[model samples]
Target: MTVPLVFAAVFMWAMWDPTETLEDLPVALVNNDIAAGTGADRLAAGDEVAQTLLDSGALKFDAVDSDTAKAGLAAGDYYFVVSIPSNFSTTLSGIGGKTTAPALISITYNDNNTLLASSIGDSVMTAIRAEVVKGTAGSSVKTVVAGLDELSSGIREAATGSGQLHDGTSELSAGASELAKGLQNELVPGTAEAADGGRQLADGTGQLASGLTDLRAGTDELGAGATELADGIESIVGGVDAKGIAAQLAALKRALPNDPSLRGVVDELTGVVDGLAQLSSGSREIANQLTDPNADYRSGVNELVAGSIELNDGANELSTGLGQLNTGAQEAATGAAQLADGANQLDAGAGELSAGLSDGARQAPELGDDVAQQSLADLLATPVDTKASNVAAAQFNGPGAAPLLLILLTALVPLIVFMCCKPLRASASQPRRMSLRTWLRRVAFVGGVSLLASAACTAIVWVALSPSPDPAELGKTLLMVAAATLMHTAVIAVMFAIGGYVVGAVTALAGIMLQMFTFGGVWMIETVPGLLKWLNPIMPMTYVREGFISSFNGSPGFWSALVIVVGIGVVATGVHLLLVRERAPHDEPLAAGSQPA
Candidate 1:
């Protein structure tokens, strides 16, 4: 009773709340990292990481130099040593720069102290890595998000500018189109008409020049005719004198004064002479006026001929100028037509440009405020958030190890009981019929005692370690213990019955070792050696441990494990029965009252 209880107590005490010892577990921390960046941007990544680990309270960390840390780890003063190299800060700081390799946090551990220490160190390093990655990645993401925000703003501004440009281009296209229409529909035809008019005017001017030349020649002839007429009149006036004619008329009248008829003749002749004198005076005045150098008629005819000649020369020049102008106008009209075509193309191109710019402006994105941007950055930085549901998590190492210890204790009970109690008591006086009955009775007695011992060990473990709180789970655990105890008891009994004391003891011890090794109490079955893994399926204690753990955790698999355990127990019991029956027939008659060996 004391032996099994003592074993349980020792195992529970050793394994109880192992993590609690981490608070005092000494580890070395060495920071050889230099600061990165300049002035205000300088960052001491090593110091920061050290501080984080120190604050985490995960383990007892002793800040030490490199040599000291190494010596301490070798001498078993420290379980593990975490060292930050000089490039840690520089490498981490240069994340987006040329640095492609990851910043390393070196972990050195000494398994001489405890192999578990190395595992613990690995776990700690993993946590440190995660924290460092989170900080660095979050910062990088924030910067990227901020840049994205700026890019968004720039895009929005560009969109606005594009919209304005589109509006301006739209107006320009419309104006260009109107200019092209005016040039094509109005200016071109007008220029052509002007060219036609110029041609017509040239022809008219040429005709006018010819007419003016003819008029000038006629004027010159008129001037010469006027002069000749004036000269002829003057000569006639010089030939006849008016005064002489008047005197002759008077003398003729005096001679004819003697008779009345003669006097009538004299009066008529005097009138005639008076008329002749008046005619002669008028002719003389006309000749004088025509022959005068300063006369208005002669000067006017000369001036008119000179003006007509000048006019003729001007008309010829005008005709030549009109012909040149007509040619120029024709060229201008052709240029205008080409310009109109170019303007029309320009209008169409500008319209398309405007439409394209407008579409681009409409398609541009808009980003919100700083707060929203930051939230998005954080989300992108750490996209996944994990949640764990620990269904039947153990709070401490003691409770977690309770099932293994309990199963071990239960298995040991049969070994302890069978060590003192004999499985078979045969004698020559004992009849063959009593052999089966006697074996049954001994099995029942041993099994009952083993069950009691298993329950007592379980109670001791529960009271000492506080393995579980649920009454139902505890009851199931007890049931698993009872089943395991019965199975072990049957196995030990059969071994003793078939092989006797020495063989039974050796077989029971070996079976216990095999079961314990393969049951995954110390290590997981998958992690065990090949032989152990193969034996794990057949080991009754493996199911016992499984059932115990299942029941303790209030999970499934208890019933299946219980069934397998009971079946193994039944098989062992049947084998024991068969051995007992076979031996019953072979038993020689021992002297009456003599005990069986």
Candidate 2:
């Protein structure tokens, strides 16, 4: 019993070998990436290749001492060793100013493991190098792109410079000819003309400098105007927090007279209040929008502020018009009250004018359209759009390339389960007595198994996350992990029902690898061969990984993918059961005691 238990434990551990760390591999890494970038966080681009290679579990490392590292290939231990050159990051300029860099990783391997080691090193190194190149492809491509742009600009400037030289030479020739002709006519006049020309040249420099100053000032003024507009918008938003509109509406209601017809008065007040509510809502939207502007250039904001100035100017005009009308109505009311001190007769005509003025005053609702324009201006003026998406991506993807723990957990658990249970085998009575109790038991069993899968997988996932990680970011990642675990269980459950442990485990593994290539988008999907590419949706891991990513990002794709993957798993399980039933072996029974007699 003790021997069997030991054997079983060892078997279980081997089947569920969870020791997936970079330290397990047999490769040597030396980081010598030295690139020029201003910021501390600016990618030391070359180390990325070495780091990725380390991430793959193919290589085992024996630390290279400084002496050996400098000398090139180290003494025995590693199958292959990588040495990155010191000038790995610096841009190269070949003869004729052609831009390219020579960032070579010299890989040397021992002769003992040459063929196998070379093959492994090559495959792993190829994948890592591809990613490093692709991830910073923007920088590389930008070098050429920017160089081309600069070259084009330089060429245009050179063309203009050539024109300037031609013009100056022509002027000089004409001036020289004139001077010679004048000298032939006589001396003092030509010399005096030369002095005048020198004075004009001096004036030309002064004028050119003045023109440049003017250009600078005009730009400064535009910038200042934009800043002022932005400041004004900030002030407005700060002044009118969410409480502002409600406060104002309450104040206005408080100010309204409580008439004999209370309902009429309340109704009248409510109408104005509704309009105010709308205006307030619109203002809030505008304020929110100002926090993130769409324009690439700050100058674009200037245009918006200029539009605001126009709008404010229009509002001032409207305000003035309202004031005049109010004044006129008061005068009319005063005249009517005095004329008819003894009667209500004057009230009617005064009321008529008052109504007209009130109606005119209510036109302030239209002010919102103009105010909304100001909001757009506010957004433009603020220049809040920041170009930091790459920074954000690096923050997330840089420190770690992937969740290897999850990858291993996903890879290993099914293997263990399948081996332990010896996978599913078809039987004759499988389809005969399908009942509600059977269905319920199967579901319960699947649920129990799923819970176990989640527990087992999540331990690995949480262990990986235990090391310091951005809390907010890791929270999202954990959510994705949880979702994926559930997804994996659902797939496992359904597959287990139809095909049992062995077949399900094998198929699931295949699906995961396929996803790693095609669906993980690890390699360029477009580069995948047409025949092989069709396998993407068929791969369960494709759905699992995409679903997880989408969930973390709050994408609808996650939910949609979840439904599809779960649904497929469930359907496939039933199909698997049907196939199993058909293939099941039946043992024919004979008379019970006949053999004994």
Candidate 3:
């Protein structure tokens, strides 16, 4: 019942639109003026505006009996009224119907309800005055005419609104039908397909994130080491000027058993004087190394990067080729299936041919029961026909996903195992762990192995796939892959070395979780909330994935991704080395996760 009343109220409001009530008022008809009087004529026009206002429901008015109205006005039962004088109607009928109607209505009102009273009195008087000017077309008539115009306009507006609503409804109806059609044609299946895609994207992103996190941790360490290196360089360069190269060298020789071959050999060997000279010479060497664009380590880094670019191209080509081959094989399988279908059809035709042969045999002269009759007919008889038989069975050959996964696993196992071993060299006992030199050798060896493995795998996959991507684009792709893979491996391996399998495993899992849920590369990133978007940068996959996309397309974004990748790699490698060097024997596997007391 409440609901019905609420609905009724809403309907009423809609029908009597407030604007209509306020802007135009409906008036009840009242013909009080004497028929022949000018006052009556003027009052007629006043009546019209009142009537129009009444009809619009814009305002409410009553043409009460004069006797009744006067009584109501005195008793305060009525707000106001238009009292037409006796000659009111006669004036409007005369020739000056043009400018005479506006001033004729004699108005009466209570002054107490000041505002309401003013509006009523003013409106009535205005209508009467307009009447003499435009016959009965006084202010009220003009207002009514305006209201009539509004009515027409309202009708047009209603039609426009209805049209829009009709279109909207039609669209909605079509959408509903299409929705049903989509359900029938694609929605259900597409949803399942999209779900599967989402799952895959999630998984891919997870892997990327884990890889990236490991890389980022590594980069942080590398950055720390770099800061230290830069500081040392500043100290060294401050120690000696470029001109003191020989004298510095000579002093360094006296302080050392060997020749002054530490940094600037012969140049630092000239005669020297002060105590600050030695420190200065040493500082100069450090500064020179830091400042020189062609320093050994920096040059090596550049070379490594260049090699990475080549590697990236190769990897991209491989991935692309592999993708194409997968597509082609699918097509080939379909073609083979079609061929098998054709062969089956041929076999069916052969069976029909065999049936035809049987029919022909029955009509053959000797085989038929008409031998005697055939003796006369034999002279005109034709030889029997025969057709070939079908003897082959249809077969289909194609690979499925499982076998491919297995093959992939088999190929990657060596690299994975190699990564596991390379990082453990630091902790090895005996001569291997005897000195800093030995440790350095181990680090270099492992780093070299990881790099070589990455390059070789990239090359193999690229060559095998033969993607035929543009060379430059292809190169960038391979570099991205190699950089990402090596960086991830180093970071993960470092974790394994520092905290054992558990720490590495946990980090890997966390990375995967973030990748699947937070980052948006595999799906619409913008769909995620602001909080997630903010968190996205923290995921290592964010950087690597972007780099991968950039590299894949040979887009301008390649450099940015490359920088991030390298940064992660450096940090990972540095942190791993530093942790291994400074590790305490009692540090637990869960140390990072554990809160200090």
- Estimate, for each residue in 217-296, the C-alpha lDDT of model 3 and write its tens digit: 45446645655665666565556664566555566666766533553444333433233455455555554443444766
Q: Rank the candidates by TM-score, best first.
A: 1, 2, 3
lDDT of each: 0.64, 0.46, 0.45
- Regions more than 4 Å wrong, model 2: 1-415, 422-424, 428-431, 465-483, 490-504, 553-556, 573-597
lDDT of 1 by residue, 449-479 (tens): 8888888887776677544434237778778
| 1 or 3, greater by TM-score | 1
lDDT of 1 at 388: 21
Quote each prediction's TM-score. 0.37, 0.30, 0.26
The lDDT leader among the candidates is 1
What global local distance difference test value does model 1 have? 0.64
Expressed as tens digits, the lDDT of each residue in 209-253 for candidate 2 is 555445545656655655555556555555544455556656666
Misplaced by over 4 Å in model 1 are: 1-397, 425-434, 467-472, 584-597
Put the candidates in lDDT order, highest first. Answer: 1, 2, 3
Note the clash tally of each candidate. Answer: 1, 7, 66
TM-score of 1: 0.37
